[model samples]
Target: MTQKKSPQGGTFKKFIVVMVIILIIALGFTGLNYYLKYFGPNVTGKQEYLYIHTGASFNDVFKTIKDEGIVKDSTTFYWSAQNMNYVNRVKPGRYHLHEGMSNRKLINMLASGTQEPVTLSFHDLRQKEQFAGFVAKKIEPDSASIIHLLDSAAYLQQYGFTPDNVYTMFLPNSYQLYWNTTPEKFFKRMYANYEKFWTPARKAKAAAINLDPIKVSILASLVDAEALHDDEMPTIAGLYLNRLNKGMKLESDPTVIFAENDFTIHRVLTRYLSINSPYNTYLHTGLPPGPIMMPSVNAVNAVLDYQKNDYIYMCAKEDFSGYHNFATNIADHLANAHKYQQALNERNIKR
Candidate 1:
C-alpha cells in the first residue's frame, strides 16, 4: 500500500515465498532421514555377542546379523555400512553387543576390529586331549588342531619341548586372549608365560635341589595328585624328594593309576602297579617322562621349596580326613599302610 505495488510484482513475490518454504521443508526431511540412517539406535539388546568368523565375506556377516536379530533394522544398517565404507572392512572376531547402539557406532567398532577378549582359565586337566578339548571350547581352534600341534615333535623342538613335556608349559591361571587366536599363537603365549614363571630364583632353587624346571613340574604333578589338602603338599613333595635322593622308587599310587590309564580306579591294586609303563613310578626309578596331570602353582612351588624332613613314605590317614601319616622307616610306613588298607576295606572301595 505504501508503494502502490503492481499486481505482477505481488504475484512474483508470492511465488518466490512459496518456493522457499518448499525448499526448507525438503531440506528438513532430508536431514531427518540422514540422522535416522546414520545415528539412530539400530542394534538390539537380545544378543550378547556377534561372532564374525575368520574368512567371512560381507554377505556372511550381514546374514548372521539378520539371522541372530542383532540389529533392529537390517536395511538401515546396510545403508549406513555402505555409506561409511565399512562393507569392505569386515573383521573377524567376537564383538560385544550393547543395547541401543547407533549404526555409526556399531559400524565403526566392527570396521576398526575392536573386539572383546576371552578369559581362559584351566586347572587339573588330566591329558593333552582333555586340555585341548577344554581350550578348544574357549578359543577358535578345534581340539584336533590343538592336539596336532601338541603332538608335533618337530614343531615343539623349536620351543625346546617334546610331545610329553610340552604339557608343562601351560601354567594353570586365568589368561586374557582373543577368541580367534590360532593354535600356534596359543602355544607361543603359553611358552612366554612359562618362561616368566620360571624366574632366576626359581631356576636356582630347582638346580639347588638337583632338579630342572621340567623335572620339578613332573614331580609337582605327583605332589598335586597325592595331596587332597593343600597344607599337605610340601610334606608329600618332601617325601618324594627323599625317595628320589635315596635312589628308591617313588611308588606313588596316583602314578600307578595314571599308568593304567584308568582314572576310575579308586584303590590301586598290586596288579595296577605291575603295569609296564614309564609312568609307573613303582617300576621306574626316576620321575615319569612327563607330568601325569596339570600341576597347580602351589604344587610346583612346593616341589621347588620342599619341606626339610626325613620322611620317605606317606599313607593316607585311616580316618579318611584327607591327611597322610608320614614315616621314615619301612616298619612304621607298613603300619600306616595297613591302617589305610583296613579303612578302605571297611568302606568297600575295592579295585
Candidate 2:
C-alpha cells in the first residue's frame, strides 16, 4: 500500500492544508478589523458635550460629531455606525461626550436616546423676560418662545394665573430636566413644582394670614426686598400685614421703585411715589398684582409665619446696618425717617 500511494491524493492533501492556512489568516485579519472598528477607541479630542437638535438627520448628527473633531477616525465611526444600524436609529438629544470612547459605546448611546439631563436653576430673577432668558440658555427653546408663553394671557389662564401673576409659579431650585424640553412642558413642570411647594400646611398658613398663595408670594417679594437679614423678614412681614389689616397703603419703597421700573434707584423719593402704577403700593392700598422679583422659599415661609406685631411703620436705620427701626405711631416713625434722611443727605443720595 505504501508503494501504491497516489500522487493525486498527496496533491489534494497539500491543497487542503494551504486552504486551511489561508482561511485562518483571513479570519484573523477580519476579526482584528472588526475589533478596531467597533470596540477600539474612536472618540478623541477635548469636547465633552454633543447637542443634537430635534429633527436632526443622521447625516447632520454625524456632521456635528465630525465637525467637533470628536472622533479620531471618521471612517471607522462611519463604518461602525452603518454596520450597527445606528444610521437609521439616530436619536436627538443632548449627549455627554467622553474622550477615548469606543465606537460601540458611542453608537449604542446615540441610538438609545439616553441623554444627559441639564441642571436647571435660577434665583432672584426680576422679570418674566429674565426668567425666560435663563431657561432658554439651558434648553433648546429660544428666549422669545418662552417669553411668548409667559406673556400669553390665554395660555397662562389655563394654569389659573394671569400673565402678571404667572411669574409666581416658578420656585427657585435646581431641576434635572432634558435640554430639549418644550416651553409648554417647562411651564407645566414648574407649575407642578409650585403646586408641590404650596402644600396643605403652607396653604393653611396662607389662609390664616388672609392671603392666598400668589398673594403670599407677592408679599414675600416685598419682604425680601425690605429685609437685609433673614431674621428680620418676620418682623417686616408683620408690619405689612398690620397695614393690610388696617386698609392702609403698603407704601413700600421697593414697590414704588418697581412701579417706576427703575431698579437703579437706591433712594426712592416723594417724586417716585407720584408714579401712578398699580405696583406703587403707596397708591394701591393692597398687594401688587404680581411679584416684583422671584422670592425665595424662605421669604414665602416668612410671610406665612409672620410675627404678630402692631408695627404700622418702619424706617431704615441711620447706621446703614441694613436693619430698620419699627414704630407703632406716626410721630416715632417720622423721627426715625428724619434721621435716615439726614444720613442719606450726608451720603449725597438725594434721589
Candidate 3:
C-alpha cells in the first residue's frame, strides 16, 4: 500500500533538484576560472627580453612588464606574483622571454634571479680607462668604479701586478659573464683566465728564450703593433728578439708614438723619439715598461715561438704593402729606412 504524492510537494521537490544542479555548475565554472587565471598562459607576444635593474622594486618590475605588453592579463599576473611571493624576490638581470610563457614561469624566473650571460669581448684597448669604460657599457658598475680598482696599487700588488702592468692580466677574447659582475670579481676572473693561458709548455718556451711572462707580453705588444698581417708576426717577433739579444735599442716606432701619447702620428719623427718616457724603446735598450696595447693571443704566442733568424732590423716595405723588409746589418737597415722614408715623402705623409 503505496500512498500518492500531493501536487504541491512534488513541485517543491522538483524545485530543490533544479537549485542543486545550478549550484554544481556554478562551482565547476568558478574552479575552472581560477585554474586558468593562475596556471594557464598569461603572457603575450613573440619572444622578448626584460631587464630588471639592481635595486628595482616590485612596482618597477610590474610596470616594466606592463609597459612592454608582455602579459595577456595584468590582474592575473599580479595575483600570481603576489601569491608566489615574487613581489619581494625581484632579481636584477637580463632575461630572455619566450612567446606564450605563463605568468608562473615568468615569475619563477624573476624570483630565482637567473640571467642570461652577456658576451664580453675587448681588443686593442689602448688604456685601462678605455677598457673600464668599455666594460662599464656592458655591465652594472660604472667606469669610474672600475678605474678606481685598476688604479689601486695595493690591490694590484696582491695579484702580482703593479698598476702599470695590470693591463696584461686581461687577455683579448670573447667571454660570457653575468651583467651584474662586480669590479673585483671581474679582475679575478680575468686573472684566472690569464693564468690558465700560461700553460707549462708556454712557460717553458718563455724560459728557453730568457723572457718572463710579462716581458714576453711586452714584446708581443710591440710585435702586434708592427705586424699588419698575421703571417708576418713571427718574423717581426724574431727581429725584435734579435735586437734584444744583441744589446741594440729596440727603437720601435710604435714605442715612440706611445711615449709621445700620439696615436695619430703615422710617421714617428726624431722629435718624438726624444721623449723621456720609459716607454721610449729608442732611449731604453729593452722591452717597454708595459704593453702599449692589449696583445692578441697570437701575438703573445708569436714571441714564445719566434722564428729563428739573424735579422736585427725591420722597416715597412716601400711598396705600401703591409709587409716589412728585414735587415741583418746597419747599412742594409739604413737603405730600407731611406726607401720607406722616400715613399712616405711621395705620399706626402709628413706628420
Candidate 4:
C-alpha cells in the first residue's frame, strides 16, 4: 500500500531475524548442557560405598573416586564440585553410592556431612586387643590407636576404669555411630552406654548382691563363659555367688583357660590351673581383676537377679547337654566331676 519497501530496510529486517534465531539456538544448547551437567546421572551402576577418611583432603577424595570408578564422568564431577564449593567443605565419613545419582546430590551429601552410620555389634570378644581390632574394622581409628587409649591408665582414670577392667565398659550390643568417630569419642560413647545400662534399679540390685557394677560385670563374664544355655545363667550365677560368699575360689574352668590364653582347650587340665596370672580364679580368690570376656546383657542381668540357693559347686553334666550339675557338698561335686571326666576320656578330649 505504501511506497515500495526499501531494499536496504528489507535486508536489515531479514538480518535481524537470522540473528534472533541463532541466539535462540545458542541459548537452548547452553541450557541443555547445563542441565545435563548438574542433574544427569553421574554415579556408576556398581553398588558400592565411598569411605572418606578423617582429615582427608579433597584431592584424596577425588583420587579415591577415580581409583574406584565411582563416577562416570570425572571431568563433570570435578567441575560440579568446584561450582558447588564442595572442594572446601569435604567431610570425612562413610557415604553410600546409589546407582544413577547426580553430581549435585552427591556433592550436597558430602558437603552437608550426611553420612550413613555403622551398626556395630560385638559379643564374646575375649581381649581388649581383639575388641579394638573389631571396632577398628568398622570405624576410622586404627586398632593401635584404640588400644593406646584403652591401655592409658591416666586417660582411663577419668572414666573410673583401668587397663585391666576397661573391657567391662563395652557392653555387647548394636550401636549406631559415625564411621569417622575418633578413638576417644568411641570410649566416651561406650562409657555413657555403660552408665545408661547400669540404671538405678540395676545398681540397687547389684548393691543387694554385695557387688558394685564392675564386680557384677566381672562375675557376669564368668557366668557367660560357663553357661551355654541362657536359662542356666541364673543358676550358675547363684552357684558362683555362693562360692564367693563362702570365701572359696571361683574355680571357673573358663578363668583357667583365659589365664593360659588358650581358647583351644576343650577340657581344662590340672596344670592349666597353676598359671600364675591374676585371671586364674582357682588361685586368686573373688572375681578376677577384669572380665575374661565381654559379658552379655543376659549374663549381667542373671548376676543381678541370681537365684537364692545354697549350691556352692557346679560341674558340667556328663551328657554333653551344656548343662551343669549343682551340689552343696564336695562329694556330690566329685561325683559329677567323675562322670564328666569319664565322658571327656571316652571322647579323648584330654588337654
Candidate 5:
C-alpha cells in the first residue's frame, strides 16, 4: 500500500535528467560543425590549380576560383588557408593551378620551381636592349637568340616589327600572361597591344601635325622625363613642336643630362651641354633616333594636341612647381633664364 503511494514527482525528475543528456549531445554536434567550418585548417589537400595572385586577400582568392560545378566553400577555405599560413603566397600572373589544391599544394605552387607565373612588369626600361635583357632574365630565352632577333630585320618582320624599331612593338604597360609563353608569342601579344593603342585616328592626327609618329614619340619620351607636371606636358610638347617647325635646336637640358647619365655636373658647362650624343638635343637639331623611354599614353597624345604658337623657348621657373616661362624672343628667354639661374644660386642647388 505504501509502494503505491510512490510520488509522481520522482517520475518527472527522471524525465528531466534524460532531457538534459539529449541537450548536451545536440550542443556537442553543433560545436563541432562550427569548428570545422571556421577553425579547421588543411581542408583541401593535393589539389592542383592554375594560379593565385600577390596582394590577393584570403577571401578574394576563394571567391574567384571555380570548381567542377561547385566552387570551393569560402568558409572552409579561409579558415584552412589562414591556419596553414597561406597568406602572402599569391603571385602575379596567369596561372593554371590544379584542382583540389591543399594548403601545402598551393604553397608549393608559389615556390621558385613552381610553373605558375605572375604578370610581367617593366621597370624604368630605357632601351630595346634592356627589354630584351629583362625578357631573357625572366624567361628561359637565350639572350643571344633574342638579341639576334632584335637586330635582325628579317627575323623581326615576322613579328611585324622592323629592325631598330622600338616604337612599333612594345608599349610601357604591364601584361599578364602564361608563364610558359614563348618569346615569339610574347612579341606577338606586345605588337598587337601596340597596334590596338595606336589607332588610325592617332596616326592621322600625328600626320596632320606634320610630325612623324615615330619621331614625335621620341621627343615625347624626352618631354615626359623633363616635365614634372601633367599640365606642362602639352606646353612642353608644343615647345618642341615650335622648335621643330622653326628649325631650332631643342636645347633641352634633360637631354643633355640623359646623355651624361650622371647628376654630378656642378653645372651644365657649355662643353657638356654640347655633348655629341644623339640624345643630346642640343647637338642634333631634331629628335633622337628612338624614344629615350617608354612614354605614357598621355605624353604621346600631347604630341598630337600640341598648341600652335610662337613660343620657341621654355624654362622651368625657380618655384619648381611645374610651371614654366614661355618665350618667343631671345631677350625674354635670356631674362627668364637669368631669373631661374638666380633662384638656383639662392637655393644653392648644384646644377
Candidate 6:
C-alpha cells in the first residue's frame, strides 16, 4: 500500500532498527558468557601461589582475585561468581593462579585442576625436633620458621616422653595439597590424619590393654629400634607386652642409648647401666620416655595386637637376625641372657 511518508520519520525508523540489532548482539554475548562461566567444561588457568588453603569459601576466592587487582568491580565479580554453575567444582587446598585473569578464566582454571601438586613427605623422623629439621630439608623451607612452631616438648610430651602423644599422627596416604605448604598447615594436615587414624575401635582396644596408644607407640619405637627385620617385630612386641603385664623391668639397651644420645650399640658396660636418666629401661620399671625413634606402622600395629602368651622375656642369641628367645620366668631369662652374652662376646665385631 502506497502512503505519503516524511523524510525525517523515515531516517528515525532506520536508526531505531540499527539500535535494536546492536542491543540483540550485546545480549547474546552476555548470555554466552553466562553459559561459559557455569556449564563450560575443563575450566583452567595459571596462579602464582598455587594453593587455595583450608577453610576458604567462594567469597574468599573472589576476594583473593579482587585483592590481587585482577578485577576492577568486585560487586560485578561476586555476582558473576555466585551465579556461575561450575562454582561448586572449586576444591580446597593450594592451586596455581594467573595474574589478571578474568572471572570466566578463573572458573575454568578451578574446574580443570591439573594444577595441584603432591606435598612432600617427611621420612625417618625420630623425634619432634627431628621433624622440624626434616621440614627444612624436605620442603627447603625456612628452618628457623618451623623450628619453634613444632616443639616436640609440647606435641610429644606432657608428663614425660613415655606418656607422650606420638600416635596422634596418622600415616600418610594419598592427599592433595600445595607444594609450598606452610609449617602450620602441614602440622594441621598431619594432625587431621592422626585424629582419623585413632578411631574409636582402636582407642577401645588400647583401653582394654590399659595402655595409651601413645604409650604403645613408645614400646613400638623400642621394638623398631631393636629389630632389623619386620618378621620378628610381632614377637618382639609380644615380649615387651608380656613384660609390662608382669610388672618387670624392660631393661632395653635402646632406652639407654636414647638417654645417652649416643647411637653406638656394640659395647655396654656395668657403668652404662648406672647412667642416671629416666629413659634407661634397665634402671626404670616401664617404657622409656615415649618413642625413641619414629617407628613404622607395622611396629605400632604389632604392639597393639601382640600375642597373649606366657613369655615374659626375650633375648637374641648369636644371630643378629632380630629373632629373640622367649622365657616365662626370670630364671629362664637369666639363662638366656647368659647364653646371649656368651654369643655376643664370641662375635664381638663392631660395624
Q: Compared with the true structure, what per-residue lDDT tens digits does model 3 show for residues 1-351? A: 998989999999999999999999999998987778777887786436788887999999999888888898888899889999998898898888877788888888889988889999999988888899999999888999999988999999988888778888889999998888888889888999999999999999999999988889988999999999988999999989888888999999998888888889989878888899999998988888889988989999999989999998889999988999999898999999999999999999998
In candidate 6, what are the lDDT values of residues 1-351, reduced to their tens digit?
898889999999999999999999999998987664444432233335534544567767766766665445555556666666545766554455555556666665665655556656644466666666655554424677675554456643432332244432535345555655676676677767767777888788778888877777778888888787787788888878777877889888778877887776665566788889978889899887667777777787778787667777777764666677778887998898888787777887441
Question: Which tens-of-lDDT digit does each residue in 160-234 have in candidate 4?
Answer: 999988888999999999999999889889999999999999999999989999999999999999999999999
TM, every model: 0.97, 0.95, 0.92, 0.97, 0.64, 0.62
Question: Pairing residues by index, what is the TM-score of model 4?
Answer: 0.97
Q: Which window of ten consecutive residues has the lowest lDDT sum in model 1? A: 1-10
Go through the candidates in order and give each one's C-alpha lDDT.
0.93, 0.91, 0.89, 0.93, 0.68, 0.67
> Which ranges of candidate 1 are over 4 A from the true structure?
1-6
Q: Answer with 2 or 6, whichever has the higher lDDT.
A: 2
Report the C-alpha lDDT of model 5 over 37-132, residue by residue, as the tens digit: 544343333344444444556455555553421225655555555765665555544445545544445444543335655477774466667778
What are the per-residue Cα lDDT tens digits for candidate 2 across 139-193? 9999999999888999998899988898789888999999988898898899999
Once fitted onto the true fold, the runs of candidate 6 whose alpha carbons sit more than 4 angstroms away are: 1-115, 152-176
RMSD of 3: 2.2
Compute the lDDT for candidate 3. Answer: 0.89
Which scores higher on TM-score, 2 or 6?
2
In model 5, what is the error at residue 71, expressed in angstroms? Answer: 23
**lDDT at 231, model 2:** 95
lDDT of 4 at 315: 91
